[model samples]
Target: MDTTIRQQAELATAEIAEVAAIPLREPGTELVALEAAPAPVAEAIRKRMDELDMTNTQSIISFGSAAQAELQQISQAMLADVKNKDVGPAGDSLRGIVSTIRGFSVSELDVRRKRSWWEKLTGKAAPFSNFLAKFENVQSQIDKVTDDLLKHEHVLLKDIKSLDMLYEKTLDFYEELGLYISAGEAKLAELDATTIPAKEAAVAALPEDDKMIGSQELRDMRAARDDLERRVHDLKLTRQVTMQSLPSIRLVQENDKSLVTKINSTLVNTVPLWETQLAQAVTIQRSREAAEAVRDANDLTNELLTANAKNLREANAVVRTEMERGVFDIEAVRQANEDLVATINESLQIADEGKARRAEAEKELEHMEKELRETLASAKARDASSDAGASVPTA
Candidate 1:
């Protein structure tokens, strides 16, 4: 990784290390209360045991009962708090914010690119302004989510402190258990070493007939010590619970503290940085769009001016040429006169050919008429001759 990132990681590790250095009461350390006492300690311990209520099991177990009950409550509270306070949703929201940031882009912002002519002239684009409004709304949402996370952090910190107190309470219970066990052991040792032996010797000195009755006190003392031993065993069991609970409390507190640290970092470092970068990106994008719009406007203006100039040049050339011309040009009049003379000459030639064709057609018609009349007269004469011949020779 980068050196800066490495340094940051080291710093974070150091902070956690410092926290871990805080002393915790090690399991079974309370056993030291039962360590070997000095030679003179037996007499003192015996006197102390004499003051205790050896026969009352209820009184003996009271402190242990209280310790166990409180430990149980603490454990339950820790479990319930762990179950009820979920950081998952907050973490998911943070991840969602990251995804949103990654997905967001200036180009995704709605911008009316094709504006009216008046809008173009006014140089007013609503895209950036609208983006600002939307960004403010999104910022509000981010703030709300962050605020909830901050509240969760506060609750976790408070719970962690409560767990610290619980840890101390567990240690106190452990020490109480050790004291009860040690005191009970000392009493047991004294009963075995001194009290029971003395009682048995006294019973031995009694007459054989009364020995059984005389040993009753001894038996009673033994029974009381047995009850004391049982109570101490109960206390030891309670201590075992406390031993286990210490680490559980610490682990829960550690988890809560770690979540608090993460939330602090997100709120103080990551979020502001992300927002700042986003704002800068938006500003840069708007600047780019503005620059592009100006360039496009300038290009469009240049194109229109060039086209208008060309059209104006062509229009002026046509109009000026038309203005310089006469109403009727001499070349046009001369071409018309030549065309009229050729037309009249072609008409006279066409009329003469028509008259000659008509006169030939009349001569042809007269010749046909004469031929027809001559053929008819010949036929009529042949018919008369045939008739006269047929009548004279009536054969």
Candidate 2:
């Protein structure tokens, strides 16, 4: 039993020493430091925490408590066994010391347990309230960013849609312009095909007389030739104007085509890609917020546990000092224990408030998530409809 007690004490002492060596700041202090410090300093702190292999501070406290309890139990049993063996003065003195220490350890353990229960009841809000606030703030900022991006996307889509309609109208106009130009060419061809040839034949059939004959046939023939020449000259001038206008129309059509291509590219590729990336950014930010919340909660839990351990150690020291002075204070111990229980109960009430707050936060998050999902679905449907419309054969 003595050997077992010695081993257990040694193990407990080592555990305690290990925990003490870790430079754990008070709850929320690290978060504050992180917020206030420069980027490089914050990053360095993060790196240091990672190197220590201390992902969860609560685990350290739990291990320390378990080791301490094991040590206390072994020591108690050793003291009892020594009393039964009829040990001498030296052994009696050792047993007395062990009994006092065991008593103090038991009281300390009870207080620690009460404190732990209180902390658990309060949840993360007690020690890490600022972290919760920060999480909410980040979420709000992300929501704003998403809203702004969606608004811009909506405007872009609307403009692109309008551009697409204009492109189709421009194409139809180009076709109509081509038909108008073609009609002018056809009119010119008709003159060459029938009227010009017939007129030339008539002029050739006329007698090559130098004298102005008073015959009606000569006058009618000359007049008809003159009328045909005027018609041909007017047709050529009209065709020249129409032909000149073609290049300007074609230039406009080329510009329309380029504009259409650009709008289509933005709609099909750039806008969608941007929306996707924005969604991913929101997701990443939410994930980061969640992770920070968890880490902060763990830090708070560890802080509470450490405080409990310190109190326990102090209680043990007081008991040991009183024993050396040949004094005991049973009433004071009882009062302290009662006060601790009352404090724990009050903390439990606070915990209820925290739970309520947490529930409200969860509901808000759910609503936001639903909104985001619907928005994404709407965007996808719009994209799909646009694609289907684009693939259809135009009349």
Candidate 3:
């Protein structure tokens, strides 16, 4: 790139780099809380579970209890048949019981594991009934929460975009306002363009009045009108202001750039210091749908947020419970993922090699995103230096 283009590129790079350097502590309170969520994904899962509860999900899993009892009975019958060496129809009956026993085993285990999943797929399989029984409402609750969260986020994004669009529209409006000033200026400029002889022409067009008496009143009125028009014209002519120039395009891309900078600085840079503390404040778990809805139910103005908050708390509790029960370290894993991504990005500023590596990654991302990327390439190619020299104004 030539000097000006290079400067633009450098500016872009510095902005991105600054973003990369941003500390995690600077995120908005909402995003920070979400990042620190005990089980963030659990929020989505909880919504689905809630919907399950609304349908009287408990009634749908009645087969789970019966299935378990039947399995135990079948096992008892099979044992008796085997001991007595029973044969014929009675033996056949026991064999059938064995088959049913096998079916019920999975059902029993599923209910014990995750009732929501099992019940949602209820009746499709004899097994997993128990797992389905466990959640009683997992999918429904998860769906509800997921929908609500996505909806809330979408609305916020739309609001920001609407404001952004209005900002652009306002620029356009101001542009038109500027032209009014220009129109006035043009009228004034006309006075400079024309000579006083042009005014005398109109006066000459009138009948000779030298011999007439009391013609001064008519002359005075004519002069007064001419003077008023001339002065107004002069004022407009001096108003040489042009249309308002468009702002730099970079300003268009930003949504509260200052806020972005501040948040990035706090969130990314100070992550190590605050991550542990954040982890302590939150919990994480996957729980049943019914349980989540109950936990999420809130009396707040936004039923959605209130519900989400409740779901968040329940999800945190469940995830925490699961973490303890299964001895799984959720925080450690989350931290590792977050830290690794951050480190890779920060390394770009350290070395030229890193920049090239990141460039390769960027290309890779582009390729992955597009199976066919030839749309813009159809434009005719030109000599790079010649084009750069051309006065198209630097982008």
Candidate 4:
């Protein structure tokens, strides 16, 4: 969607086009024919064929891409390498063929060429026949090497392609997995933002779950909350009662003590002190129960938060693990691509360079060969001239 990506896409398209135009021909057959030729004429025909041969670079590139994929898997394997790096090997092989092409140039062909004047000068002489033998041997050596290089490349390319396909599927898996992780993270953030406070609020409302606890406990908590509310109301009434009673007690204090003197009873009134004690105890228990109600609310809220946190943490762990796997995979794919390109380029360059050097050497060899033939002819002429004068004596 962005400019950089768009540019890359365009470049890929152009590359595909360029590679498409490059033909991938197997040059070994021609080389073999040249080797199998018994004499100069047959070999010359084969040479012409090779000279005219074309290559399909695009197909080679396609095959090279496959090899790249295989290398990726092999490089990233955590397990016993059940899979191999087919692409790297295959590409190397194919590129080697490309190298072979450059290595055996037209000069090499010329180096092996029949001297154009051989038919006229030597006909089928043993020396001429001997030259042909040596030529054929060299030709066979070149063909054998070429065949091997091409054959190896073909096998490797197929394997690399298979690996490449698997690599693609692996990458797709990571992409989908990453999306799930991203979504999960977003959900985690939302949960964290809302769950803590929401759980607290839900518990405070004396919700149905709390209302169901032990049935008896639920009733007690409700009773406690209600009593607190009611006591506040009751305290209003108690205020009036205590106010009136307080005035009376004060009045009693103002009156004579002998008439109001209290009597202690062991049998019927000994427990009279228990009334004051029991009233005080009941008041204290109500206050404790009220405080317990608020504590229950907080504890329930905390329990829910702790449970939710556990689930969230588990979910996050899964996402983190998955993301790490994806990251590893993504890096592997990127590196594979880089290696693939380098391999192809290096192969092409090697082929081109080898071809150039071989061509140059072949040309120089051709020139030397021509000079040797010419000098030999001149030497023969001199020998004939000298022999002419001494012919009688030699006989």
State the C-alpha lDDT per candidate: 0.70, 0.45, 0.39, 0.43
Q: Let me know the TM-score candidate 2 reaches against the reference structure.
A: 0.23
lDDT (tens digit, per residue) of candidate 1 on 158-251 = 5665677678778877765665567678777777899789888999999989988888877877888787778778767767876787888788
Q: Please write out the lDDT profile of model 2 over residues 120-153, one tens digit for every residue.
A: 7776343234333543454444334333333333
Name the runs in model 4 displaced over 4 angstroms. 1-131, 200-395
The number of residue pairs in model 4 that clash at the backbone is 10
Clashing pairs in 4: 19-58, 22-56, 22-57, 23-55, 23-56, 23-57, 24-55, 24-56, 67-87, 102-355
* Model 2 misplaced stretches (Cα beyond 4 Å): 1-214, 291-395
Candidate 2: residue 5 Cα off by (Å): 76
lDDT of 3 by residue, 293-368 (tens): 5655643347877789999999999998877664547888899999999998778657878788999999999996
TM-score of 3: 0.21
Off by over 4 Å in 3: 1-150, 195-197, 208-395
RMSD of each: 14.6, 54.9, 54.3, 62.6
Candidate closer to the true structure by lDDT (higher is better), 1 or 4: 1
Task: Evaluate model 1: give its lDDT.
Answer: 0.70
Assess the local accuracy of residue 163 in candidate 4 as a C-alpha lDDT between 0 and 100: 36
Model 4 C-alpha lDDT per residue in residues 352-377, reported as the tens digit of each score? 99999999999999999999999999
Ranked by TM-score, the better of candidates 1 and 3 is 1
Cα deviation of 140, candidate 2, in Å: 23
